[model samples]
Target: MSLKQQLKDAVAKQKKARDITREDIVKNAAAIQRSRQEQKDLSNRPH
Candidate 1:
């Protein structure tokens, strides 16, 4: 098997174990990004 195929298989196995859907990942990533952005904005505001 090629390296790409091996990686694909590993990812499939991990997804099955975690039962993580793409939407779940996207939602959590977006929420984290939003929080980080909010903190950065607050820190850069006029003192």
Candidate 2:
């Protein structure tokens, strides 16, 4: 499954037992984007 789908599934699972806000999803998505960008940047740098 795709990462986005996995994220949504995770949030849905948590929602079943607790509260999850849109802000939480936004924050997590932002964090993932930042992390992916950092990995890409590192990969492009000279060894």
Best by TM-score: 2
Q: Candidate 2 at residue 4, lDDT? A: 100
Over 4 Å off, model 2: 1-20
lDDT of 1 at 42: 100
Give each prediction's root-mean-square deviation over alpha carbons: 7.8, 13.4
TM-score of 2: 0.56
TM-score to native of every candidate shown: 0.53, 0.56
Worst 10 residues of 2 by lDDT: 16-25
List model 1 lDDT by residue over 1-47, tens digit each: 99999999999999886766777888999999999999999999999
What lDDT does candidate 1 reach at residue 29? Answer: 97
Q: Global CA lDDT of candidate 1, please?
A: 0.92
lDDT, each prediction: 0.92, 0.89
